[model samples]
Target: MRRFTRNAAVAAAAAVAALGLTVTQASATSLDTWTVTPGGSFTATATNPTLTVPAATLECASSSASGTLDTGSGNPGAGIGTITTLSFTDCSVIGIDFDVTTAGSMPLNVNGVSSVANAVDGSITNIDAHVEGTACSADFTGQVTGYYKNDTKQLVINDGNLTASNADCLGVINDDDPALYEAVYAVSGGHTITLD
Candidate 1:
């Protein structure tokens, strides 16, 4: 097996926008505060997330899943809550990151891929969080990293800094080799990405 690494700063910036996150400081006093919100239609982000596999297995459409899958923010009020969905059409690369502060450890199934429910990708770092009352708050203290490849049927995550607290209903929709969506990081503000 080989390893692929990208600049954390660059990837973070890209992934944030790709997922339709509105990066903003909590207030004037905050130096590095940011918030992620879902954007337009066709675009998909996370609020209430869900994952399901047909029967109990996921079959790859092609022989290889070693390419990159670009991500974008999904439309809001889709009745799917605040969950981001990564659709897969071609056997491309796919990875997912959750807002540690907003969404906490939620169940995940990578279909034919390996287990990542309790595993964090190594590519992600710099996460900070503190529990307040019954709620947990987190800051994007570090990068969120992971990888999803279909050829090897594997998903990798390596982060302890990020956090998520999704207690809402987990929604999972299945499609025959569906389209995979990844988080987006805005370039010089924003750009347009079509899933099809």
Candidate 2:
């Protein structure tokens, strides 16, 4: 496997930490653009929405990058955590819920990507999941869907619950029109959320 840039790797790592994906392989900076459908209902209180983009360019380069989800209102209560050697934990995961909705085009370089949410207290509930491998081609879609137990440090999923969705449009795209690359999405609506 080719070596990736430190910054890109760190950025990718940051996304992994935030999105909860354990990437075994590496790739170039994959671009992901999405838009929220708006008028959607969510029962989970989302906190710190995150998305990672590879630092490098192209699928052959072996780079990565990412960004966090926002309220479509240009406001993220707290920024997503960066990937580091230290096991960095989200400062306020104790009382946070998360939900996501994305629509647009995404092209990935690798075969599969993952996301994880671990419980700090070992008794609380969070969410995490890994996406299965898919062919590298246009019009492909795969979803790495699941929930984690933050307090319990465990993952509880129902039938076919761990991997909820999949498609070719899941990964990141390389070069696309500026307008096409633009993403719009939102993560909100949670019962556990407590307004300060």
Candidate 3:
């Protein structure tokens, strides 16, 4: 009787294991590498703007920027990528034509990702804008908060701030001052993109 009981218990355990009930695998799938290209042209505008140069306050009329978004093999919800060939156009200061001629890249990351919504909010950081004008040229640092929509393939920058040092500007304006200015940017031109 004792041998029979032991055998029965072992058989039940074996049956449970054989049914594949011991371990479970996750059903969720993570996104791999993907690239987003602009489908059409986009624009950005500055708000609550203040430009302190030589004690002069100015506001930015508008900003035109475009770039490609790339995510190199990682989870879309929490991943890091780069924006290449990012350019700015028609950014003015104090009613003067301010042009950003130097093209550069920006570091981007996604947070609070929602697969159901098909969207991800992120930040654009470490932006080095090489700006050139008739009177002065300078390198400015930019930070922005934006979102990406999977359905529309659009990346929008709703709010942003730009800062530049007197030294970075080559002593043209604000030669000894560093100040923060408001800016807005977007990218949505008949662009093409691939998600893998």
Candidate 4:
């Protein structure tokens, strides 16, 4: 009787395992995969944008930035990509050196095909900015508006703006009051992104 019970238990366990395998295989066929190629070189810029701070508002006369896209994969409708090689130049912030750069890839939502009206919004963190040899960092929220030109294989970031506030701009300005010590930044520019 003991031997018979042990054999029955083993058979039941094997049946359950077979059922699980069949369910997993059925679900796997229903799943869809999407592959996104690198859209090539991308660039964004801002010009003479206003930055409002707790103490005062600062205006940058000229600011420009650029980056590139990385290869990605996801579902067909819900895919994502990243921006790499981000660099900023010719930025002029009042009382602060306009030297800024991104530390990591900026994420972008990937729709079926690249469209001009598609909404691409993300945040850039660990930004490195320098003022009079003093190094500081802050996070920036960016909104990019543009279209993907299939003819030219380029992604255009036109009339885009990036804003960051509540940043501690130490040694950039002389203020005794702590409330007036914070600084804000705004940059605007239009750039063309090349997709290969």
Clashes of 2: 61
Residue-wise lDDT of candidate 1 within 110-149, one digit each (tens)? 1111243422122322223221211222222223445433
The lDDT of each candidate is 0.26, 0.24, 0.52, 0.42
Better of 1 and 2 by lDDT: 1
Writing each residue's lDDT as its tens digit, candidate 2 over 1-196 gives: 2355877898888987866443422222122222222312321222222222232111111112222222233221222111111111232111232122223422111111224332111011122221122331121123222333333322222212111233232343222211111111122332011111
Candidate 3: tens digits of C-alpha lDDT, residues 1-196 = 9999999999998998866543432113233334444322343333333344454444454444444344233325333556555444455665666665434666666654545366666677777665566676665676766666666655655545656653434455654344454444434553333444
C-alpha RMSD by candidate, in order: 19.9, 21.3, 12.1, 11.9
Per-residue error for 12 in candidate 2, Å, reads: 42
Give every collision pair in model 4: 45-188, 45-189, 46-188, 46-189, 47-188, 116-147
**Best-first order by TM-score:** 3, 4, 1, 2
Predicted structure 3, TM vs. truth: 0.48
Better of 1 and 4 by TM-score: 4
Worst 10-residue lDDT window, candidate 3:
24-33
lDDT of 4: 0.42
Runs with alpha carbons beyond 4 Å of true place in candidate 2: 1-42, 56-140, 150-196
